[model samples]
Target: MKRFLAFVKKEFFHILRDRRTLLILFGMPLAMVLLFGFALTNEIKNAKIAVLDLDHGPHSRQITDRLLSSGYFQLIQNLNASRDIEPAFRRGKVKLVVVFPPNFSQDFARNDTEAQVQLLADASEQNTAISLTNYATNIIQNYKSEQAPPGTVAPMQIDVQPRMVFNPELRGAFVFVPGVMAMVLLLVSALMTSVTIAREKEMGTMEVLMVSPLSQLQILFGKVLPYLLLSFINGCVIIALGVFLLGIPLNGSLLLLLAETLLFTFLSLSLGLLISTIADTQLVAMFASLLVLLMPTIFLSGFIFPIESMPRFLQFVSNIIPAKYFIEIVKGIMIKGIGLDLLWKPTLLLLGMSAFLMAVSLRNLKPRLNQ
Candidate 1:
């Protein structure tokens, strides 16, 4: 009994002495609980939408006003023409557009025919578009019902026709496949690279390489090159599986998609190298990668959960995650068939992140010349 107690005590001491492990052990549970409880929700909030109020009637204006007041949507633009709706969607500025045809109030008052309101949604993000359309339709219906006289049928009738652009049929796989690609590539590339580099440090080969003729950048590139190729291959496999097994369409340019995948892989590799520099051991590196990369990639990247619904602070935190941008790029290309014109922002963000991580990793990598 005494021997067993001594062994347990030694283990406790070792755990307490390793601050990184101790921190991760305690912090991971807290983060998971907080993220699941708060950030990971299916609800939509502050979704950007545009209003094209061609009617300009009192009833039309009232309906528009109510929509803006609802917490679920933010009115980014009040469009003047029908022509502007497609442009707004293409710019990725708005998910749904509410168009009130002229003589909306007059038609509603007559009750001879139903007054029509068109709800046009950019269905590239099919789930969000569906949610927004449903919410808007419900609100408009409620308003129409309220205008009725007591015990009398309401003369005003509003018919909402929801049109889902890009993806006419809302397929769950369409939304998730791209997200899965991002998460899988990130995990396989970042976690694997970090663990491999940390293994070299633990085994003492890193010092030998440091003293060799190869410069730090060259050594880092050499270490990363194999993983880069492997990650690219993995990406291709995942894309193929999504297309063949899942029946998700690859609508956009295949060459562009491959190029973007390579860029994202580079970002993940740089992040892994950065993690390796921060952690002294393979276990520590693995834990760091899981905590910083995996959790955020899955939860905060709009993978399984919507980022807009998360708390404001969490939304801000998500902006720094590389997977968030990459997922956006993938979805735009695959689902919307959008070109570089619509995708430049997220593409640039990934590029900037790759450069930042590489610079920081190089700075932190102080390979011992003589150990």
Candidate 2:
């Protein structure tokens, strides 16, 4: 036992003495969180909207005020004719062009009179078009409801307006690209980290380390530190791609993103450590990591499917997966732009899992090679 204690001390020295590794340990987590946080959300604000108000009457002005007051839309143009809409849409300054057809008030003169507002939105941006359309519809409907019922109202009415948000103009691929990056990053980091220590053993390096005076805990730290850093770098790569190339939003607090990412990185590294202790070779390690971390995180993490829509069993099972929490934190910070108060639950869960993995790893480490 004394010898084991001495060994642990020696291993710690090797790691602590290496400044490069320690720097990476701290740097990687912060970088990855910021990158992934921005990459994983699609909610857009401050999108440009164009108006072609042919009515020039109280109704058109009222509709315009309502849209602006909602704080969801910004008007880009006021056109006297409907023909100007297509040209504006082509100019790309307008994602959605609103056309209040001539005599819009005439239709609204009766309490139930039918009015048609043309919302020419860029279908290219699916989510933006859809979101703006819904808001505009709701605003118009609310205005109509306030008026007395006109002579037998038209059974149906449609109001269309196109104002986009974020990547306004909902380019579908633009939506999930960030979340996909988070998934890929977690997989790359977790899988690589899981196999690394096992690879050292397969190459006979672990035997030499085990025979050294350094402690097992130190050895474990040294191994995990490298992959943790690497995983963080992978996360950074994902973030850069999502932000610069994909134009994803980074509206939330950068600090919160980093803190959450660090917790997740610690959890992933510890999980990799647990896998290393159990596996005999790098291939087995790789296979095991994929089976344990890859499959579960992907299917259960709400990356592709809505968590609420999932089966109750799946919903319950997701609580145990570290990736689940990471996904939530990523979406919450990046997409929702929410703060720590709302995110503490997932953050705490991740920390608890990391501690559990680290504890089990320590208990599992054998004091001697033969044991």
Candidate 3:
């Protein structure tokens, strides 16, 4: 037990002594959280819009005021004619053009049945245009509601009230933060462990450790323990940034979240160890870790895309990516506040993968020692 503790301590010293490793261990999570939370978000803010108010009436001006006050849009141009609308969009000054028909205020005041406005959006950026249209529609609808006399029901009106659960405001950070956590934990744990072990091989120190009294399991555990601890810390840092900085809610049990994080870290570390055992050099191990672990985690894990929306074959391929399960586990725990009852399947899958990888890594490591 003392020898095992000493081995763990040696690993810690090795990590602490290297400034670059320490920076990557601690700094990368913060940088990624800030980058994803602030820069890489889908939420539209200050989107430029053009208004072509033909009516030049109170109701049209009121609608424009509502849009500007809502903070989603910035009025960049006022078009007098239809010809100017294309020019505004061509100049890239506006993402959308709102055209109020002639006699818009009088039509609404007379309660005309067919009062309407037209929204022309730049289809070049499809998602942004869609979001802008939705925002404008919501603002216009609210304006209409406000203008309507109290207790007056419109014929064929269907009231649709949307309640956004978890992230009510639909902040993109809420979507990306959990994914960043999964990707960061997996990449950092796997990359660091694989590179560390491969570096030992490159430096010819692995044979010295093999000659020592430490068993193969002890040596493997020693290498994994430091990274496991570090990865857990990294996970905590990410969760903290999400909650405090990005306002992501952690509605489930904190202990459960941490336990699940530790499980995923173990899974990543085992996979890294397996890579280290197979690859002969640090470069090979690093590339193998990036290509094998990082890309799949980012693309197939439902990190940035929906796995269900993917084709059947790609969905089946995603099953092998451990981050997919971990991301679901995280969103379940953090966003939905669901307990183990809802998350048992993914938890079991992660556990099984961790055990399988650890077993394979130990098997591979044992044969190498004999050689």
Every model's Cα RMSD, please? 2.1, 15.4, 15.7
TM-score for candidate 1, residues paired by index: 0.93
Q: Residue-wise lDDT of candidate 1 within 87-161, one digit each (tens)?
A: 888778888999999988888878788999999997767778888999999999999999888899887788899
Residue-level lDDT of model 2, residues 1-371, one tens digit each, is 99999999998899899654464466546644643454323343445788877788887798889888876777878776766765565444665677788888777765466778877665434565676677778888877765545775444343454444344445555546545655665666567766777778678777788878888768777877876777677666766676677766666787787777667777877777777777767877776676677766656575554343344565687779787767667655664466777777878888889899988866765542335
Candidate 3 per-residue lDDT, tens place, 1-371, comes to 99999999999999999665665566657745644554445567778888889999988898899999987888888999988976665444577888887877777776434567888875434446567778888888877776656788642121223323345466777677778898889888999999998898888898899989998789878988999999999999999998899888888989999999999999999999899887778877886787678877876776764443455666688899999888878877777677787688889999999999999998897787667
> Which stretches of candidate 3 lie above 4 Å from their native place?
1-159
Off by over 4 Å in 1: 1-7, 211-215, 244-247, 368-371
Winning candidate number (TM-score): 1
lDDT of candidate 3?
Answer: 0.78
What would you estimate as the lDDT of candidate 2? 0.67
**All candidates' lDDT scores?**
0.87, 0.67, 0.78
Worst 10 residues of 2 by lDDT: 35-44
Candidate closer to the true structure by TM-score (higher is better), 2 or 3? 3
* Alpha-carbon TM-score of each model against the true structure: 0.93, 0.57, 0.60
